[model samples]
Target: MSDKAKLVLGDKTVELPVFTGSEGEKAIDITKLRAETGFVTLDSGYMNTGACTSAVTFLDGELGILKYRGHSIEELAEKSSFLETSYLVFYGKLPTASELKVFEEKIASYNDVPEGIKTMIKAFPKDAHPMAVLSSNMVSLSAYYHDLCAQDLTPAQKDEVIVQLMGQLKVVAAYAYRHSQGLEFIKSDGSLDYCSDFIYMMTGNKNVSKEVAKALDVLLILHVDHEQNCSTSSVRMVGSSKANIFATISAGVDALWGPLHGGANQAVLEMLEEIKNSGKDYKTFLAEVKDKNSSSRLMGFGHRVYKNFDPRAKIIKVACDSVLKTLGVKDPLLDIAKGLEEVALRDEYFVSRKLYPNVDFYSGIIYRALGIPTNMFTVMFAMGRLPGWLAQWKEMVEQSGFKICRPRQIFTGDTKNTYIEIKSRS
Candidate 1:
């Protein structure tokens, strides 16, 4: 095989170098294509583009494989805590006992968010979206803590930023929810673990069940990193401009609030609620979903990337069950969600297309069981995704050759035409 891919357009031939990743993933490096040939490839939705090469998370959608630092999701979810997985994702290695201790201590040290941040969350209306409040408070951190944002951060300074976000993001998430509920803010418990502490802060109770903490820890580990998804890309894109850490994350929080990204779980819950209120059985609704003429569709049945199954879904599905059993909570929406999963898995229409239950399918159910309201689901996702965003931003900043991400587009409109004056236009 040649070292370059030759693209012959008419009589002009272009040579684009090929690059291979550690896992044999191949891409034709087109960094110089437009510069040399005065032409650029068009990839709509970036469906066929590789924005950046990353070592943080590896995802194989076809095979339903997800790994972090070369460890399988199953292994990490079962054996590692969220903080441990976070350390691995950022530093490229699991932490030693002493390292883990120091990391935990660092988190504990920075756990308390500023009074102004608490005040900011309270300022939002009671019915305001938690994501909106969360993003506002997140960006405010940059203004409150200017020392953490350096145009060129040293390794220690970068780590400090990462640790600070890891420490405070959960508090912000929980506080935002409380403010939405018109409840008072709760501080973190020094004795609780990371996930447990967040749960305590959200509910204002340090006494938490063991099973609940385990379930949350596993979910966080599963969400630690995904290869350049929407929010991660948002972080990298905004950070390319040398924005502060909080500002970049604020951008990500907004991106994740979109209905297509981190809002899937919220949609799932809403769909379940809609189905429950429809006065029809799930089987009847499932038929409507299968009918092409009908407008009904399943919310969490399939994924955009995973044609087979979502690896995270397979892991978190069990946690969902465990959480339901542990809390002994009951809801009609959960029953509908469970029934939909069972019937869809067996139905030919679903099985043929591989539209199995995805990660978000049961996540909202689990969140509901834990007493977390539907509106707060995406904020929880932002909390879990914090570490991944930090790692990706840190990697992009540390790369010496990285350029600002400026994607090109083909112009389809008329050019070289004089603009008509507003008064003369018919």
Candidate 2:
């Protein structure tokens, strides 16, 4: 509404320029706040802060809008494959027919991971968490491709690294899944496309149905990119120091491994199990969630970013029904999930609070139908989020005004303290 926002102090005034994005999202430029007025804004968790302006994805949480490079998510999910969407996220444009053919062929050519990496993966315990294994191998990739991540690298060299990582990470995830199950690792099939190959490797089912492959492709597309999520920010923070992609992505994997970040789907399943085991009806459990008297809480029903419905949830809900019906899955847990969602939508308490089912709500249920274990939930999330992290990191490297992400903090501890010898203190 205004070109600049004015803040008044006792005797001085500060004017910060108000910047609006292409989607009409506004953020005040606070870069000069500390310098001009010796005051820095304190925004814990950066909920209201604009850390950086990104051109990769646009999200309006209140309106439930999410778009990647100007394409509506629904369009991509219905029409494009994961590889095509990933290329769009990475390069900020959809690949042309010829470009798509070349990119897919190149990815196929670099499918298998290094043998040494596989040997190392085998050494981990069979019960080892897949995310840990995935991160370890991703970091180890730096050693195998040192030249690509070396200093003074060219744009073409970095692109090679990106391509290699994108293709091989699928292999790495498949290996991690097989490793966790103590199953022999399977090589990627050159005949399969990206999502199909991943499904094949994970399940060792040569004839994965067309429905399953399309389901996974849409899932990946829905999660292709979100604007500056925690793991993506973690990636940009580490990459700001000019870290190698492997190391930076490893940081992201660790961040996503946290329960609060990428484990919501697992938490959702655990919550469902808790409710089912408690012998309480869905309505009773939901009442406890609203009452707060019981220690019960609803997981995956709401998101921190979105105050309205999660746009992805709308699409995924339809896909969830289709996948289950097509596969003839009849899990009682899914029935419970559906029951919970139905009750939440009809109840006034949930509707007033905007606590509708988020994307993780349905994604978890579908993954269960697809036979993905609770432990591998976050690993699957990492696979979907890979392109977003890479796109953010690459933008930081090529764009201007990005530096090592060091935040200013208010000093609340003792300003000065004398070092006391142990005897003297006693």
Writing each residue's lDDT as its tens digit, candidate 1 over 1-426 gives 677999998899988999988888889999888899888989898888999989999888889999998999999998999999999989999999999999998987777788888878787888999899889888999988777777878888888888888888888888887777778888787788997888888888787788888887887787788879999999999999998989999999999887677888899898888887877777888899899998657877776678888989887777877787778776677778878888888899998887877778888888888878899888888888998999999899888897888888999998889889999999
Local distance difference test, each candidate: 0.86, 0.84
Error at 106, model 2, angstroms: 1.5
Off by over 4 Å in 1: 287-296, 346-354
> Residue by residue across 269-376, what tens digits does model 2's lDDT show?
898888788878988788787886676567778777888889999998888888999999876777888888898889888778788677788888787777778888
- State the displacement of the C-alpha of residue 91, model 2, in Å, after optimal TM-score superposition: 1.6
Quick one: RMSD of model 1? Answer: 1.9
TM-score of each: 0.95, 0.95
Q: Predict model 1's lDDT versus the native.
A: 0.86
Q: What is the clash tally of candidate 1?
A: 0
